[model samples]
Target: MPKTQCTDGVVGAILASWRYDISGISPEMRRDYEQHLAECARCSARQRFHRSLDGALAVLTSLSALFFLFALSVLKHIKPLEHMAFKILGLDIYDMYHMLISAGVAGLCFSLIALALVLMATPAPSYLSGIAVERARLIEARLPERIRSIRLR
Candidate 1:
């Protein structure tokens, strides 16, 4: 909240809090240390570490939730999927050509995206010109009227 660079005492406090929460102190002037952290820089770093950890944990939880939901949905549709593929199409249940196709498609997509990024960039002009575009334009503008007329013609 206070944008000013915090002191070392504050940093100690943040670290103390993390250590206390994880391992803990013998006697409870943990309160005093916490107060000191509120004033110091060391503790602020600890707070940032804690916040980053919490963020990562939250992300992990979200991803796991998504995975489980997808798995559940897949389970629900499994019978219909198998019947559609194996029964109707007469493909072997053990065959995994779909995986290869998906992998190929992913590779192609990544390559195409890379190619697009490469193509979208402005290529550096030839070094022999030895001048920037604006300077070149100015020089071209200052050329003889006869030369300009010839160019126009």
Candidate 2:
């Protein structure tokens, strides 16, 4: 039963939402908003709005669960690392066939994730993706120190 500072019109609207009035509320002067809404259509719209806001908040809670389900769907297979690497990169590295797939697959997955993140963050011409790819490669090359420096910044 907090004191409402708004004009009577707004107070009536809040009362109208819950179908209540100012005469016999708690502590003799406070108003229950829900009780007021039940008595008024205008206030009922506000009530519905509050419900919708709650629904929107629930959506954010479910988003992380959806992401978890999607990732589980994508990478749950317990396959050999080499096979996983090739599958991830779509590479035909026959020479690396005998090597362990773990490192290559991980690298490919990391690159793909970085690409996805960069794509999402940097909105620009399509050429930017290619440039990012090249830049990521150059950073990995003889300029390792430069890459480390950039990372610090």
Worst 10 residues of 2 by lDDT: 119-128
What TM-score does model 1 achieve against the real structure? Answer: 0.37
> What's the lDDT for all of these models?
0.52, 0.50
Q: Which candidate comes out best when scored by lDDT?
A: 1
Q: Write the per-residue lDDT of candidate 2 for residues 40-119, one digit (tens) a residue.
A: 55555544554444444444434544554454444445343456677788766654443434444555565556545543
Determine the C-alpha RMSD for candidate 1 after optimal superposition of all C-alphas. 20.1
